[model samples]
Structure formats: C-alpha cells, structure tokens
Target: MKLTQIDKVYGKKHVLKNVTLEFPAGKITVMVGPSGSGKSTILRSLNLLVTPESGQYDFNGHQIDFSQKLSSKEKLAIRRETGMVFQDYNLFPHKTVLNNVIEGPTQVLKMGRKQASELARELLAKVGMADYGDVYPNELSGGQAQRVAIARALAMKPQYLLLDEPTSALDPELELSVLKVLLQLAHEKQSMVLITHNMAFAKQIADKIVFIEEGQVIYDGGPEEFFSADNPNGRIKNFIASMTMENLR
Candidate 1:
C-alpha cells in the first residue's frame, strides 16, 4: 500500500500533513510513537473510516481516488479488503465466541451458516482458542478476548489487517499470549500495519518500522537501521530510548 501526499484535518487542527509512504505488500509493518501521535489516525484513514481531506491511497497497485466521492458499493469494496482490530475488544456481549467470529462472514459476506461455522472453528484453532468457542467474551481474560477479536478479523479473509495497540490492555502474562498469536500470524506471511509500543516485539516481527510524530512519518527503515545507535535521527533515537525505559520499568 502507498500513501501519496496524504492530508487530513479535524476541524481546525491538521492531523496528517502531506504524509507519503509506501508499505511493501505481504510484509509486517509496525507503526510506533508516543501517545496522541496520530498512529491510529493514519491506520484509520487507510480503511476510509476517517476520510482524508486530500491525497491518494494506493492498494495492490490500484490508486484509491479519495478526491472523488465514493459510492456505498465502492466503500464496501475497500472495507472487504481491509480488517481492523481495536485496542478494546469489540465483541458482541450477547454472542458466544463462536457466533461472534462467524457473524460477519454470515451476515456481510453471505456465507452459508454451516460454512461460516466451519471457518470460525478453523480460525479459533489458529488463534489457540479452539476450546473457547462456546464461551462468552466476558468469561475470557482480556488477552483471550483480543485473540477472539483477531479470529473475528481473520474470518473475513482480509488482504490487510490493521491493529491498534493489540497488547496494551492486557497484563504482562496475558500480553505475551496476545503477542504470541500476532507473531504466529506474521510467520504465516500476513500483511499487517500494527500500531504498538512494544519495541521488542516490533524488532522481532516487523519487516519494517515507521516512526510517526505529530501525524507525519519521521523515519521509515528496516529493524537493523532503526535500532542502531549510530542512527542520526534524534526523534527515532529518543523514541526508542523511551520505549526501552518503559519496558525496563
């Protein structure tokens, strides 16, 4: 995916200012920054949840013309290719875990109920939640809830996945569980744009890292180039130092 000269504004404040970056296909790209740095906003704009005021989004070699108005059908087409996972597990309270995973496939994609159930079971197993399909979201820990959310996102067979702070809500032990599942996905060659503070995880799993500050990308490079102390970008160095301190504490 490529973002060219992208610009977004909220009321009077400019959130994304002419940002341009290219995300290689079929690679894990992690976005890291301090809080309120617009990392999530950049992800949201890619799926059109937050429309850009100006600029273009290109996906799979097709340039998304944000300048022209999109029809409902066009919007749905883009959404079908992208899936988003939020920090909060947005599962339906009344639905069982199995049902929560299958609901979108059955309702949105019009898959047969039986087929959706089979797919749901397969995805649940993939996320290490095969035994919890019958359980309710409230019965699971925060990490489990997030795993179920991941299963739900994968059910749509999205070409790209957007994750916003996937482990921030979990305890240390639970955070590892969630991170493990993400690492598994990366190994399976899933293309993802992840917004996270876990520098260690990023270094291990991300093929590329994009550092954002004040709604613009300040550094974009491979893990080696980014983590090197000799790097000249002060913002990148300081951000890495802050994350390291947070992890140490």
Candidate 2:
C-alpha cells in the first residue's frame, strides 16, 4: 500500500501534513511517535476509516484521490483487503468468542455459517485462543481478549493487518503475551502496519520505522539507525531518552 502527499484536517487543525509512506507486502512497518503525533490517523487512513482531505492512496493499483469523496463501494473494497485491530479489543459483548470471530466472515464475506465457523476455529487456534471459543469478551483477561481480536481479524483473510497500539491497555505481562502473538505473525510473514509507543517492541519487530512528530514524518528508516545513540536528530534522541526513562520507571 502507498500513500502520496496525503493531508488531513479537522476543522482548523491539520492532522496529517503531506504524508507519504509505503507498507511493503509481508514486512512489518512500525509507526512510533509521541502521543497525538498523527500515528493513529495514518493507521486509520489505510482502511479508509479516516478520510484524508487531499492526496492519493494506492492499494494494489486502485488509486484514490482523497480530495474526492469515496463511494461506499470503494471504501468496502479497501476495507476488504485490510483489517484493523484497535487498542480496545472491541468484541461483541453478547457474542461468544466463536460467534464474534465468525461475524465478519458470515456478514461481510457472506460465507456459509458452517464454513465461517470452521475458519474461525482455525484462526482461533492460530492465535492460541482455541480453548476460549465458548468464552465471552468480559470473562477473559485483556491479553486473551486481544488474542481473540487478532483471531477475528485473521478470520477475515485480510491481505494487510493494521494495528493501533493493540497491547497498550495491558500490564507488562499481558502486553508481552499480545506481543508474542504479533511476533509469531511477523515470523509467518503477515504484512502489518502497527502504531506503537513501545520502542523496544518496535525495534524487535520493525523492518521499517516511520517516526512522526507534529503531524510530519521526522524519520523513515531502519530500526538500527533509528534506535542508535548516534542518531543526528537531537529531538529524536531526546524522545528516545524520555521513552527509555519512562520504561525504567
């Protein structure tokens, strides 16, 4: 997926400024930055959840001019190729885990119930949630619920998975559990675009890193240089130091 010169605004506040980036197939691209730096907007824009005000979005040669309003059919087509997992698990409270996972396939994809359930079960096992199929979202730990969320996304057979701080609400132990699941997916070559503040996790999983600040791309490069002490940007170095200190505390 590619975005060129994308710009977005809410009222008078410019949320994204001429943002251009690429998400390579079968590689993990991590977006790391301070809070309110437009990382979420960038992630949401990939699925057309947040409509940009200008520029182009190209997904597999389907070019979208953001200045023009997107038809529902266009949005659905983009979304069909991508699945988003948010910081909150956002599971259906009244649905069983199996039901929650199957909803998208049955409703959106129009797969038969039996076929959707079979696919859902396989994805649930893939994400280490096989035993939780009968469980409700409220009954599980944050980590388990997040895993179920992952399974639900996977069940949709998305070509690209977009995650926005999927583990941010968990404790350290629970966070690691969710991170482990993501690491496994990365090993399996699932194309992913993730927005995260955990610098260490980003380094461990990123093939490319896009550091955003003030609604602009501060740096777009590999993790080795982005995490190195020799980084030339003073503000970025300071940001790293501050994040490190926060982790320590």
Candidate 3:
C-alpha cells in the first residue's frame, strides 16, 4: 500500500501534511514521531479509516483520489484487504471474545459459523488467548483484551495488518506477552504497518522506518541508518534520544 501527497485535516487542526509513504509487502514498517505528529493518521489512512481531504491512496493496483467519492462496496473492499488493531482494544462489550473474533468472518466475509469458529480459535491460540475465548472484553485485563483484539484482526485474514500501539497500555509483563506475539508475527514476515512509541521494540522489528514530525515525513529509510550514531540529521538523532530517555525514566 502507498500514499502519495496525502493531506488530512480535522476541523482547524492540520494533522497530516502532504504526507507520502509506502508499506512494502512482507515487511514491517514502523512509524515513529511525537504525539499528534500524524503517525496514527497516516496508519489509519492505509485502511481508509481516516480518509485524506486531498491527494491519492493506492492499494495493490487500485488508486483512489480524494476528489472521488467511494461507495460502501469500494470502502469495504479496501478495508477488507487491511485490518486495523486499535490501541483501545475495540471489542464489542456485549460479545464474548470468541464471538468478537468470529464476527468479521461470519458477518462480513460470509464464512460459515463452524469454519469461523475454527479460524477464531486458531488465531486466539496464536495470540495466547486460547483459554479466554468464552470470556467477555470487560472480564479480561488490558493485555488480554489487546491480544483478543489482535486475534480478531487476524481472523479476517487481511493482507496488511495495521496496528496502533498494540502494547502502549499494558504493564511491562503484559506488554511482554503482546510483544512476543508481535515478534512471532514479524518472524513470519507478515505485512505490517505499526505506530509505536516503544523505540527499543521498534528497533528490534522494523525493516523500514518512517519518522514523521509536525505532520511531515522527516525521514523515510532503513532502521540502521536512521538509528546510527553517525546519522547526520540531529533532529532525527535527538528524537530517538529523547524517546529513549523518556523510556528510561
């Protein structure tokens, strides 16, 4: 998926500014920046959860210009190809964990309930939630709900998985569990675009790194060069240092 010259605004706040980015297939592209720097906006744009007010979005061979309105089918087509995992673990409060994971496959993809249940259980097991399938979101801890959310997203079999801080809310122990799942996914070469404040974790999994600052792509390149000590861009180096320092504290 690729975005070219995208611009997004919310009321008076200009969140994304002429941002252009690309997520190569089978690679983990980690997006990092300060809060409200449009990292989340850019990630959501890939799944069309947040549409740009202008410019273009391209997925596979399909190109969508901001000027052209999209029908429900078109929107669903794009969204189906990309699954988004929100930071808040947006599970249905009324639904059990198993039902939450199976809802998409059964309702949207039209898979049979038995098949969907099988798939959901498989994904739940993958995310270390095999035993919690019958539980509700409220009954689970933050990490458990997040893992269930990951399982729910995976159940769709999306080509590209978009995650917004999958571990930001969890305590260190809980965070480690989610990180292990993500690391396993990364090892399998899943096509992922993640927005994370965890610099150390980002460095471990990123194949490509995009640094956004004040709603602009400050840098877009490999993790090595961006994280190098000799990286000439002081701003880039300082941002990493600042984030690292914050993490230390």
Most accurate candidate by TM-score: 2
Candidate 2 stretches with Cα past 4 Å from truth are 246-249
lDDT of 1: 0.89
**What TM-score against the true fold does each predicted structure earn?**
0.96, 0.97, 0.96
Colliding pairs, model 1: none
Name the 10 consecutive residues with the lowest summed lDDT in model 2: 240-249
Model 3, C-alpha of 223: deviation from truth (Å)? 0.5
By lDDT, rank the candidates, best first. Answer: 2, 3, 1
Report the C-alpha lDDT of model 3 over 104-212, residue by residue, as the tens digit. Answer: 9999999999999999999999999999988989999998999999889988898999999989988989988888898899899889999998889999999999999
Worst 10 residues of 1 by lDDT: 60-69
Off by over 4 Å in 1: 246-249
lDDT of 2 by residue, 1-249 (tens): 999999999898999999999999999999989999999999999999999999999997689999998999999999988989999999999999999999999999999999999999999888888998898899999999999999999888999999999999999999998999999999999999999878889989999999999789999999999998899998888888887785366
lDDT, candidate 2, equals: 0.93
- Candidate 3 — which residues are off by over 4 angstroms? 246-249
Question: On a 0 to 1 TM-score scale, where does candidate 2 land against the true structure?
Answer: 0.97
**lDDT for each of the candidates?**
0.89, 0.93, 0.91
Better of 2 and 3 by TM-score: 2
Clashes of each: 0, 0, 0
